[model samples]
Target: MRFMWLPIVESVRMYLQSLPEIAETYEVDLIGNLPKGGGSSIEIDWEAERGAAETVNTTGAVAVHLLIKHRTDDTDIWRAFREQYRIQNLILQEIRRLHDYILTNLKIAVKISATGVEPLGDMVRPYYGNELILVFEWKGAIRDGRYES
Candidate 1:
């Protein structure tokens, strides 16, 4: 039994580097090794809405959440991560596009849940080896109160 999620571990450096504003906007703390969190026993620190330019928080704002989960084996984790890598790359390249689209197209509020959606996007973690990455995102922007329903 071999447990290795090096792909995701390796990609974190590049992924964080890719988004410089993330660090500047919100407080980010990297959690090494799995902790007593929810499922997967993995914990990562991320502050949503880092360096937001013009967050539209309104009364009628509707929040939407997006999610992507990868299921695979520990040794086969690379395959799942590859799929997410491309997706993240696309998102990175067209981040502005999504931002613009949300404003113009989606009338209601929008939020995305990248929880456990690591840049590596791998599943089938080894029960023994502590190798994991978690990605998270806020759904939408509303008033001072959080947006629900």
Candidate 2:
């Protein structure tokens, strides 16, 4: 398929990439709708949690998924688990950082409903040495369409 470009999504990607914690680790890559691969990448992917009608004003939800991976040389089971734990915690910290960033900067006004983290297993396409998925749920008022007489 041909490459697709989205300006709004790119803006979102830049927002994630600009985060100090995330940038310090690696060049922030916005996975967008593309498949994940490449050794050790930090990516931000988000989707509308549900469809919305064409209304003047309404609330909507967006599920933001943060994917983080760091290649490690440690092979021992215990050491790997410890490394995984560390990466998971760091990613969570970064997610918190992003949440705060959005609250402070995004004046459109979105409420973060929930946050969570889960392990992405090694068998995945990315084939991570250590993988973690951080989830942030954001709810905000959306204005769509024009009011008719």
The regions of model 2 sitting more than 4 angstroms off are 1-16, 19-21, 32-39, 49-51, 77-84, 94-106, 113-115, 122-149
TM-score of each candidate?
0.28, 0.56
- Model 2 per-residue lDDT at 3: 12
RMSD of 2: 6.8
Q: Highest TM-score: give the candidate number.
A: 2
Report the C-alpha lDDT of model 1 over 1-149, residue by residue, as the tens digit.
Answer: 11112222233333443555433322222354323322222223333323234345332211212222323445775665664454445435634444444434333233332333323334335321222323323334443343433
Model 2, range 1-149, lDDT digits (tens) per residue? 11111322354466656666555655456654434544455566666544244244333456655565554455555664565566556555555555555445442334443366666665433234433333333334433322112
- Which residues of candidate 1, in runs, are more than 4 Å off? 1-65, 71-75, 106-149
Error of 2 at 69 (Å): 1.6
**lDDT of candidate 2 vs native?**
0.47
